[model samples]
Target chain A: MTSVLGPLALATSTGALLIVPLAPALRELISKRDAGPLVTRKDDGNISSFAASLRTRCISLHRMLDDCAKFGDNQLIDLSHGSAFVVGQSGAWAGSHHPVALVACAGSVELPAGFQSIADFYCRGNVRCGQQSIFRSLLSEEEIALGNDTQVLRWVHAESSLSAGRNCRLYGRASSAKLLTLSPGCSFERIYAPVIYSSTEGTALNLRTEYAPYARLAQSGIGRTRVHGAMHFPADEEHRGDAVATRNIDLEQGACIFGSMKANGDISLKERAEVHGSLVSTKRIHISSGCFVKGPIIAEREVIIDSGVQVGLPGTPTTVSAPLIHLAPGSVLHGTAWAKTEGRVGD
Target chain B: MLLGLFTAVVALICIYTIRHYCFTVNRIIGQQRHPYVDVDTAEWPPVTVLIAAHNEEAVVGDILTALLEVDYPAEKLAIVPVNDRSVDRTREIIDSFVVHYPGRITPFHRTGGRAGKAAALKDAMAYVNTEIMLVFDADYVPGKALIRQLVAPFFDPEVGSVMGRVVPLNVGKKLLTRILDLERSGGYQVDQQARMNLHFVPQYGGTVAGIRKSALDEIGGWNENTLAEDTDLTYRMLLAGWKTVYENRAECYEEVPERWPVRVRQIMRWAKGHNQAMVGYSALLLRSRNVSWWERFDGLLLLGVYMMAPVLLLGWLLAMVLFYLGAPVGGGLAVLGLAAFTTLGNFAAFFEIAAAARLDGSRARIQLLPLTFLGFTVSAISVSRAAWQQFTSWIRGQEMVWHKTERSRVAPVVLEKSA
Candidate 1:
C-alpha cells in the first residue's frame, strides 16, 4: 500500500500544474463569450458628420449665397491689384500681401463666385461665402480702420497685417458668419460657421417655446379630438390645434394620422401608425412596433421606441429628447436623439 | 492510495476555488461594459402582489402596511396575503387590512393544503388575474417605489422574472446580523448583478421578485415537492428560454436571523433545498437544448453552491490529519501555491462585499466584513450536517420534513422606528 500510495501521490502532485491554470483560462473564455458585444464610446465624429451631411442636404450653399448677395453692398469683382482692397472707405493694408480682397465698406460682403486671387480677405461686419468659394483670411469687422503707413482702399476698410500661407483662415471678433467650407485647419474667433456645427446643445427642441403652446391649446379644448381610428386632415388643419387626450392617447394598430397630437398623460402608438406630425407628451411616450413618425417627438419623461419604428422625415431629420430613451431591437432612427440620463439600445 | 485520493481532492478544491474567484473578478470587470439603468415607464400595468405567510403574526402587519403604501395606482394594484394555516394572529391582521381596503386587499386563507410556501403560492395562483405578480416573504418591508421597479422588467417580452436586492433590517442589532448583511451584499450586489451584466443566470431569490403570469403558467406553476422552489423555478425558466434579470436598484429591507442556531437552521434548509434541486434538475439542465453551453455550465455551478461547504470541510480535515501525521501535504512549493489560491478564493468574498458596499454608498458597512468568517464557519457546519442528514435519509428511504425558521416579534418595533 505504501508503494502504491507513493507513486499515486507523485502523479497527483504533478497534475496540479496542469489543472490549476486550466480553470481560470476556461472561466475567462466563458466570460469573454458571455460579455456579448463590446460597448465602445459613441463615435461623436460619426454623429456630427451625419448631422452635418443631413443639414447640408436640407440647405444648399447656393441658396445661402443668394441670400447673402441680397444683403451685400459691394460685390467682389477681382483681386489682381493688391492684397487689401476697400470698396467705399479708405483704409491701409497693414500686413504682408493679399492676392484678392473684397472689403464691404457699408454693409456685409457676399462672395457669390470663386475669387481665387485674394489670399487675405476682410469684411467690416458680415460675410457669406458658398462652397468652392476660396480665400486666405476672411475677417468681419464693424469698421476696418487703417493706421499710419498702411495700405488702405478708399471707403473700403481693409487691413492686411495677418499672414495666410497655404491654409484658409477666418479671423475676426464678430457675431455670426455663414461660411460654406470649414475645414479642420481653418481658425475662427467667434462666428456661426455651419461646417463646424456639431453640438446638440443649442439645437435641442425648446420645450417652452415650441411645445408648451400645444399643451396650453389642449387645455383650452380647441381642435381637440379623441382619435379612435385613422384620421386625415388638410394642410389648413395642421396648426389649428392639438388633438389632446386627457389620460392616454392609444393609437390603435394600423391607425393613420395626418396631424399633430398632444397628451397630458402617456401616448401609445400601435403598429403601422402613419403619423405625419409631431407628438408631444407630458409623461411617457411608447412607440410600438412598426410605427412611423415623420416629425419630432418631445417627451417630458421616458421615450421607448419599439422595433421597426421609424422616426424623422425623408429629407429632414428630427430630434427625440427625453430623460431616458430606450431603442428596441430592429428599430430604425433616422434622426438625432438625446437622453439626459442614459440610453439603452437593445436587450 | 489514500494519499493520492487526498491530493486529488485538494487539487479539485483548489480548482473550484480559483474558478469561483475568476468568476467574481470577471464579473467586476464586465460591470463596466454593461451598467444597470432603472426602468422608467409611462404606463403602469395591473399587478397582483402575493404575500405568503405561515405564523408570521409579528411581521405580517408591518409588511401589509408597507405594501399598502406602495407608490402605484390604487385601481391597478391588487394585494393578496396568503394565510397558510397560521395558528397565530397572522390571519386576524390580514383580515383587518382586508376590511380597511375592501377591494385592494384580497386575503387568501388556506386551511388544508400541502403546508409549504410552494403549495400556498400555487393555491394563490388560482385567484390572480393580473399581468404581473410580485412575491414577498412576510419579513420584507418594501419601499414605496419598489412595486414599480419590480414590475418594470416585465415590459420586456423575453423577461420572465425580475429579482430585487435585499438589505437586512436587523443589521445593527447584533454581530451575526451584521455579518449576514455583508454576506447579503456580496451575494446580491456583486455576485447577482455581475451575473446579470455578463448574461449569466441571475437567481430569483424567492422574495422581492416579480413574475409574469403567463410565463409562470407556461412553466406549469411552482413545483410543490421541491425544497428550494426558487432554484427549481429559476432553472425551469431558463430551460424554457426565458430570461430572469436582477434589478439592484429595486431594494427591500428584510429581517435576517439574529441568533446563531436560527441562522444555522435557515442555512441548513437552504442547503438541503439547493442540493435537492441539484439532484433533481442537474441531468435535465445538462441535456437541455434551449440553453447555451456556457449557460449550462453556469447553471450547474449555481446549483452546486450548497456542496461547497462540505468540500471545504473535507479540505480542512485532510490538512489537519496530514499535519498530525507529520506528512508534507504536498511539497513546500505545492502547498504554498495552493495556499495562495485558497487565500485568493477567500478574499473574493471580501472583495465583492466591499465593492458592493462602495457601489451602494454604504462605505461604513465594509469595515464589518472581517466578522463574516464567523457566519461562514456556521454556514460550513450547517451545510455539512445537512448534507450528511440528507445522505442518511436517502439511505434509510425516509422523507424529509419542511422545517420553518422561527421569526422574532421585533418587526413592529423596527418598522415603527423606520417609519
Candidate 2:
C-alpha cells in the first residue's frame, strides 16, 4: 500500500498542474456575469424626449396639489426641489426661483422680472422668463419668450413660436414647433424650428439664385489643391462637381459651386459666392454677405455667416453647425443652428 | 521545398501578429477620428430600411413596431421586410405589420429565390426608392435615433458605405456569449475604429450599416454567389474608389449565438465566404490604382482576416511534420505561437481585447481573457476545416450553401429592449 501511494502522488501532482491552465475559465464559471446593458441609448440631444419622459412619469392634479391646496387647484404644491405654483390668471408678475410655475391655458403669463429657477417648470399656455433668470429647463405647451440676460442650463421647448431677447444665454437645445427668433447680444447652443430668424433680414446678393451674364462666369475646374497646399477658385467661376481640398479653400467673390465643398483648412466663401451643396470643413467656415449655402454647413471650429446671408430655403431647412457660430443681424437660417460652445446673434 | 513552404507560412503568420500589435498600440494612443458623429442636425435624406428574414416569426413583429417610432421624418422613412421563402409564419407576421402601419412597413415577399441573404437583398433592391438603404437583421433591435445616426455619413459624397457597432443581446446566458461579447467590443471599439483613423479599411458588416444606392449600382448590385456578401461588397467598394466609414458610437443590439455548435457553424460559414473574396480580388486590390497606398495594403490584410485561422492551423501541422522528419525548426515555434494567439483574442489579439475593454469602460469580466485560448483553438480548427472544404468544393465545381445561426427569445414583449 505504501509503494502504491508513491505512484498515486505523482499522478495527482501532474493532474493539478494541468488544471492550472484552466484557471481563468474556472474563475469565469464561478463568478457573476459582468456584461453591460445591451441597449443603453445615447443622449440624442433633443427637446421632445424631455417632455416624453415627464409625461410618462406624471402626477395627477389631485396628488400634485394634495398638500398645498387650502382652496382649489390654483394653489402651489411643495416639492422636494422647490414649490410648484400653478398660475391661474394671466398677468405680468415677478417670478421666483423656488416655485415651479405652471401657467394656465386661460392666458399668457409674462415673468419679465429677474429670478433663478432651481426646479423644472411646465406651462400649458404661453410664458415668458424674466431678465437674468437662470433656469434648469422649461417645457411649454405654447409659445415661449425669453427676457434679456436670461440663461437656461439644460433645454427649453415650446409648441408654438418662440423668441429670445437681448443678452440671453440659451444653452443646450431650444426648439419650437413654428418660427424661432433670436435678438442681438444673445448666445445659444442649438435652435430648431421651421423658420429661424437669427437677425433682421437684410438685402444682399443672392447666392442661391443664378447670377446673370454667363459671359463673366467661367467654368471652374473645382479648384485643385496646389503643391503649396491651398485651393483658390478664381472669381466669377462655376463648378459642376464637388470641390475638395486638403488645405485652405478660398472661393473668390461671385463664384458658383453647384456641388459639395470639403476642406481640411479654413473655407472662405467670398461675398456673392454661392454653394449649392453641403460645406464640410475641419477649421473655420466664413460666408460673406450675399453668399448662400443650400445644404448643411458644418465646421470643426467656428462658422461665421455675415449679414444678408440665408442658409437653406424656406420650408426646405438645412443645418449650420459649429462650436461657435457668429451670425450678423441680416442673416437667416431655415432649419437648425447648432453651436456646441457659443453662438452669438450679432457678429 | 519543405523549408521554403515553412518560411512562407512563418512570414504570413508574422505579418498578421505585427498587424494586430500595431492595431493595439495605435488604438490606445491614436487620434480617434469620428468626424461624422457630431452631425446631428442635417437635412436627413430619405432612407429605406431593409430587414431580410427567413423564418423570423419570433422576432419580426417587434423590429417593425420599434422601427415605426424612430426619430426620422414620418414621410421620408420607410421599412421593407424581405421574406425569403420562409415556410413558417414569418410572412403572416410581416403582413400583419403592413396592415397596422399602412405606408410605413412595405412587405417584399419572395416565394422562390437562390436561398440566401444576398439573393433576398438583390430581389428587394427594385423596391427601394431612396438614395440611402440601411439593412438590419430580423433579430436586431435599433434605438430611436439610430436611423438618423446611420444616414448622416451620406451627406459626404465620398462616403459610399457606413458601418455601426453591434452589441450582443443575450450576453449573460452562458460562457460562450460572454466571450462573444468581449470579441464584439474588441472588433468594433478598437480594430475597426483604428482602421478608420489610419485611413485603412473599415468593413461594412451587412447589418446595421448604410449603403448609397448609386454606389451600389456602380458596383453592379450584390454578389449573390458568395456566402459572405458583406465582405464581398466591402472589397468591391474599395476597388471602386469608394470609402467605407465606421461609426463606433452608433451601437445596435443583436442576438449572438449561445451554444458551441451554433458558434462553430457561424465562423465556418464566414471562413468559406471570406476566402472566396481573398481568391477573387487579392491581386486586383494590390494592383488597383484608384485607391491610396494605405488602402491597398490594409485592404489586403483585412481580406486575409478569416483565412488567418486556417493558415495558423496549417503552421502548427507543418511544425509537427518538420519535427517528425528531424528538420531544424528554430523560428517555427514562434510561428506556431503567433498562429495560436490569433484565435485567443476577442476577435484577433491578446492586446486588442485589453485595449477595447479599456476603451469601452467594461472591465468586469476581463478575468475571462485566458478562457479565450480554448475558444480560439476551437475556432482555428473549425476555420481550417472550412477553408479546406472551400478549396475542395471549388475544384469539384460545387456551390457553397448558406448557414444561419438558430435563435430563440425568452421575452416576447420586450421588442426594442435587449433579450
Candidate 3:
C-alpha cells in the first residue's frame, strides 16, 4: 500500500515536474525565428544606408518577420519569409566558391534570404525544389531515377553537384590522416559528387589513375580531399580484390584501404585490399585470404597474413623487425625485410 | 461510535493538510519573479485591440479614450469596436471617435443581436491582421501599462491565452461590493497566481485576456450555448494543449454588481455554465497530452468547489441543529470549533486578497480588511444562491439564462478612441 501511495503521489505531482523543466523546452520548440537573412532587390525607392541598418537591426530581433518598422533613421520592410540569410543589404558576397564540407553529426545548415521554399525544405515540408539551385536533390540522377521514392541523402548546399558521366578517382593518401578513407563502392558518388582525396594536414600526393579519363584531384579549400593516413588499402569499385598497380584487381568485401590507421587501430580484412602508403601502427594488421598489397608495412606489435598473399617488388626481400614471423604454407611474400637480433622470422 | 470519531479525525487532518499546502504554494506564487533575459520589447509585434460592446454607451467612450493614450506605437495600435445591438448612444460615441481618430479606430455596429459577442467578434476577425489580439469587455478601464503586460507572454509561443488581473472599480461603493471585489481578487490574483506559479491556470478571465488569434480559430470559435463563454473557451484551449498565463502586472478595473441579487444571478449563471462544461469536457481534459497533470487536477478541483461549498454549508447548519437538539456540551464545543475553523478559512482567503491589492499599488483598500468579514457573509449567501441555481438546473435539466452583468455605474475614465 505504501509503495502504491508513493507512485500515486509522484504521478499527481507530475505537473510540478513540467513547470520546472519541460515548459522551457516546449517554449523553445514552439518559438520561431522572427527574422532571417535579408534578400534585397536593387530597384527600390530611395532608401538610405542608415535606414537599411536600422531595418536589419529590427529584422534581427523578431521571432518571425512581420511588419517593417521605421525607427529614427531606419526603415524596415517586412518580407514575412520563414527563413533568411543576410547577404549584406549592399556589398560583396564572401565565403563563396569554397568547397562545402558538411559535417553531419546533428546540426543545422541555414539558407540565405528567408526563402520560404528552402525553409520549407529544411522543415521537411512537402514542396519539391525544381532545378534552380545547387542544393536541390532532384538534379541527382539517383533521385530522378527513384522519382517519388527518393530517400533523403546527405544534405547539399546546392543542387548543382550531381552528375553521372565523369569517371573520377577516389583521392587521398595515408600517413597521419587516419580518418580519411574512401567510402566503399560508388553508391554515394551519385549524391556527394566524385570522391577527391584531401590531406588532413598540408601535404601533396601524385595521384595517377589509369583508364579513368578524369583524374584531377581537389587542390585546395576547406573541403578539398587530401592524404593523411600512411598505411591503408585502395579497393576497386567492385568488392572482389584490391587495385594492385600491375593487375587492376577489384577489392574484397569490406576490405577498402585505410591508412594512417591510428596507433591502436586494427584492420579486419575479410579479403585484403591494396595498400598504397606505409603502414605505421602499434596494432595488429590482419590480412585475410586473397590479400594483395604494394606498400611499406610497419607495426609495433605484429602483422597477420592469412592465405594467398602477394607483396613488394619481384626482387625485394621480406623484412620483419618482430621477434617471430609466422607464415602458412599457402601464404606468399616478396620484400626486402629484416629483423633485429632479438627478433626471428618463420616461427 | 469509534468509526464516527475516526472519520471525524481523518476529515480534520485532511482539511488542515489541504489548506496548509494551498497556502504554502500561494506564498511561492506571490514571490515568483519573472526572469529578465533582456528580450527586446521593440521587436514585439503590432497588436490589434478588439472590444465588443453591447449597450455599453456608459463606458464605451472612456474605454476608447484610454486605449488611444496607451504608450505604444500609435500607427501599430488599431482599436476595433463591434457595437452589437446597442440601444443607446454607444454607436454615436463610437462614430465620433472613429471620425476623430481616423485610421486608428474602426467601428462596426450590428443592429440585430444575431449571435452575441462571439459572433460580433467573428465578423471582425478578418480585420485583425496583427500578430496578437487583446479582448476586453465594455465595462473595463485598462491601465496604460496593461496592454504591454498582457501582450508580453505572446513572446512565449506556447502561451495561447493570457489572463490579466481584473480589479474592481466599485470596491468603495458598499461593504458587500467591497467584499465581492476582494473575492474576485482572491480568485483572479491569488488562486490564479498560485495556479500559474504551478504552471497551470484553471480558467481564463474574460476581460483583459489576450488570446492568440490562431488558437482562437483552432478551437472553432466560442460556444454560444455556455453561460461562461470565457471559461468554456479556456477549457477548450487547455484541451488543445495551449498554455494559459496569468499576468499580475496587467490590470483592468471592471464594475462589480452592486446588488446581491444581481451578483447571485451572475455567479449562479457562471456555476451552471462551468458545471455543464466540466461534464461536457471531462474526457477531453483527462485525455489532454499537452497540459500538466496539475492543471488537470486544478481544473477538476475548481469544478468541484461549487458542489463542495454547498455541501459544507449544509453540514455546518446540520451541526448547529444537532447542538440545539439536546446534544452534549462536548458536541456543542465541536460545533463552535467548526465555526471558528470556517471563519479562519475565510480569513485565509481574504488575507491573500488584501496582500495582492496592496502589492498592486492599491494601498487604500488594505485598511478595509477589518470589515471584510461582513462582506464575506453576504458573499456566502450569494455563493449559496449560485450553488442552488446550479443544483436546481442540474436536477431539472433546465437551461440557464445567461445573465449579463449590469454596467450602469461603471464608467471608463478615458476613451479608447481618440475622440
Best candidate according to DockQ: 2
- Local distance difference test, candidate 1: 0.61
Model 2 C-alpha lDDT per residue in residues B1-419, reported as the tens digit of each score: 66677667767877877788788888988767776765666557788999989988888877787789888998989899999898889999999888877888889999996889999999999899987899999988888888888887766655779999898877777888888887887788888999988879999999999998878988899999999999999999888767798988888888888889999999999888889899999999989866778888899998888887776767677767776675665555644544565444334485788788788776566777777677777888899899999989989999899997777764554534432
Q: Best to worst by DockQ, what's the order?
A: 2, 1, 3
How high is the CA lDDT of each candidate model?
A: 0.61, 0.77, 0.49
The top-ranked prediction according to TM-score is 2
TM-score of 3: 0.50
Count of clashing residue pairs in every prediction: 21, 0, 68
Question: lDDT by residue for model 3 over A1-347, one digit each (tens)?
Answer: 99999989998799687556545323322341111101111121111222233334434433321111111111222335422321221111121232222111011123232111211121111122222222222111111111111222323212122211111111110011011111111111111111111111101322222212211111001010112233233444322211111111223444544221222244444564544323333344556655554344443345555545544323322222222223322443433222211111121
TM-score of chain B of each: 0.92, 0.95, 0.84
Comparison by TM-score, 1 against 2, better one: 2
Per-residue accuracy of model 1 over A1-347 as CA lDDT, tens digit each: 99999999999988986666555434433343211111111222122232233233323223433444455322344434433333432232122234343332334444443333244344444444333444433344432211111221111212212211112333332111221212222233222221111111212322111322343232212333534332333322233433544456667777755555655478788776655556766578899877776555766687887766767533344556566676664454434454555444443
* TM-score, one value per model: 0.58, 0.82, 0.50
RMSD of 1: 18.5
lDDT for model 2, please: 0.77
**Across residues B1-419, which tens digit of lDDT does each residue of candidate 1 receive?**
54565576667666666655655676556533122232232235689999989999989998888888877889988999989989999899899988888887989989997867898899999879886899999988887778877875553444679899887776665667667877887788778887776667889899999897767877889899877788888988888766688887788888888788898888888888899989988999999876767778878988988887787667556555665665655444444544665566677767777777666656445565555666777888899999999999999998777767788755373443432
